[model samples]
Target chain A: MFKVKVYVTLRESVLDPQGKAVTQSLNSLNYQEVTDVRIGKYMELMIEKSDRDLDEVVNEICTKLLANPVIEDYRYEVEECVAQ
Target chain B: MFKVKVYVTLRESVLDPQGKAVTQSLNSLNYQEVTDVRIGKYMELMIEKSDRDLDEVVNEICTKLLANPVIEDYRYEVEECVAQ
Candidate 1:
């Protein structure tokens, strides 16, 4: 079996209010050394095939379901299945 | 700047309808080696400082805003960000 890791993040042009809120909170706590924060989402998928073309499979997934191309960008990697 | 990675997936005990749907699709497409599929989300956070303690900061964000801890478990890493 193989494991796939997908990472989704906002396009740089977009604003992430949720991330900003956290950054603001941190700043309030006197972590002045901090300046900015952006939040993103991650996903893992376990599949039984590795012999197939992973790049094509991942491309199909990313465009079809894993991400909304309009606002988010996603990247993925496949590896041998290990400890869930 | 430092980037944080967070992953959220359905707790092993819960059923992932979306993942099941994908599994079914892959099977229908004749990818017989595939047996199961689980989907999770990934996120990255960009911050201006790494000099501060990252663990505590990430914990606070995960608990307070980034994720719903009741149903999700997350892991993160800090690295010198090379791109947006």
Candidate 2:
């Protein structure tokens, strides 16, 4: 099997309200060292063994569903998962 | 500055409806090779130059706000960011 780790984040130009809220919360907690925060999505895909080119499959999935290309950017890493 | 990347994942025992939905969507899109999907959160914190131990601060933030230890697991990577 393949373990695919995906990260989706808002584009630099987009404002992230959730990230702002978190930063404010941290500041209120006395963590004055925190300058900024950006919240995003992380996903793991347990892909069954397949002969197809993994890169192509993953790219399609991320572009089509995992990320909203207009406002978000995504990247992924794939690793072979040893069977038990 | 320091760039900290945090990944928060649901515990193995927890049910992930969002992941299930994504898996179903992939299956419908003919990506039959996908076996399972797990969704999580990714956050990036930009910390200003500070004298405090970063690991300790990150640990506290993750536990107190970034993740619910009862249902999720979180890990982070910290890197120094060169000033522009």
Candidate 3:
């Protein structure tokens, strides 16, 4: 099997209101040292070994379903794993 | 400054309906090799240097704000970085 970990984050140029709200909440809670916050999504996928190229499968999945290309960027790492 | 990356994930025993939905969507789209999916939150915080211990600050933030200890687990990595 293969273990794929994907991270999807907002584009740097995009406004992240959710992140700003979290930052304000933290500051109000007395974490004044926090200067900024950015929030993203993390996903773990377990895939059975197949003839398809791992990178191709991962890239297609990220582009099609995992991220919104216009506003989000995604990257992934794949590792071989022993299925339980 | 310190760059902190935090990952908050559902506890192993918890049900992840969002993940299950995504998995079903993928299977319908023909990515049948995918066996399991788990979704989580990823956050990045830029923190200014302070008198308080870094670990203590991070731990408190994770426990009090970033994660729900009853159903989620969190881990973080901190690195020294030059402020822009």
Candidate 4:
């Protein structure tokens, strides 16, 4: 089996309201040391061992469905996982 | 400066409807090799250099606001960030 960790973040050019709100909240909560915040998505996928090229499959899945190409950018890591 | 990356995921015992939906979609899309899916949140925080301990500050922020300790689990990575 394989464990895939995916991270999706908004494009730098876009404004993240949720992040802004969180930052404000942090500041109000006395965490004045925080300068900025950006929120994104983290996903994990477990894949049964197969002969398919894992990279190609994961890339296709990330682009086709996991991320929004227009506003978000994505990256992934794959690791071999022992069967339970 | 410090760059902190936080990952928040549902506890193993919790049901993730979004993950289930994504897994079903992937299967229908012929990515039958995928066995399971999980969805979570990723966040990036930029902190100004300060005398305070980054770990303590991050831990407090995460537990108090970033994650729900009851149903979610969180982990973080901290890296020194160069000024732009």
Report the lDDT tens digits of candidate 3 across residue range B1-84.
Answer: 999999999999999999999999889999999889999999999999999999999999999999999999999999899757
> Per-residue alpha-carbon lDDT of model 2 for A15-77, expressed as tens digits?
999999999999999999998999999999999877888899999999999999999999999
Candidate lDDT (C-alpha), each:
0.72, 0.96, 0.93, 0.95
**Top-down TM-score ranking:** 3, 2, 4, 1
- Pairs clashing within candidate 4: none
lDDT of 4 by residue, B1-84 (tens): 899999999999999999999999999999999989999999999998788888999999999999999999999999998878
Please state what fraction of the native interface contacts candidate 3 reproduces: 0.89
Which residue pairs does candidate 1 place in steric collision?
A40-B43, A41-B42, A41-B43, A42-B41, A42-B42, A42-B43, A43-B40, A43-B41, A43-B42
Docking class of 3: high
**What fraction of the real A-B contacts shows up in model 2?**
0.99
Q: Per-prediction RMSD in angstroms?
A: 4.0, 1.0, 0.8, 1.1
**Prediction 3 global C-alpha lDDT:** 0.93
Winning candidate number (lDDT): 2
Give the poorly placed runs of model 1, Cα more than 4 Å off.
A21-35, A50-52, A82-84, B21-35, B48-52, B81-84
Docking quality tier of candidate 2? Answer: high
Instruction: Report the C-alpha displacement of residue B69, candidate 3, in angstroms.
Output: 0.6
Clashing pairs in 3: none
State the lDDT at A66 in candidate 3.
90
Q: Write the per-residue lDDT of candidate 2 for residues B1-84, one digit (tens) a residue.
A: 999999999999999999999999999999999989999999999998778899999999999999999999999999999999
TM-score, model 2 to reference = 0.96
**Higher-lDDT candidate among 1 and 3?**
3
DockQ of each: 0.43, 0.90, 0.93, 0.89
Candidate 1 lDDT over A3-82, as tens digits, reads 77777789999998987886787678766545677667655666665576877877777777667899988888788876
lDDT for residue B48 in candidate 3, whole number 0-100: 91
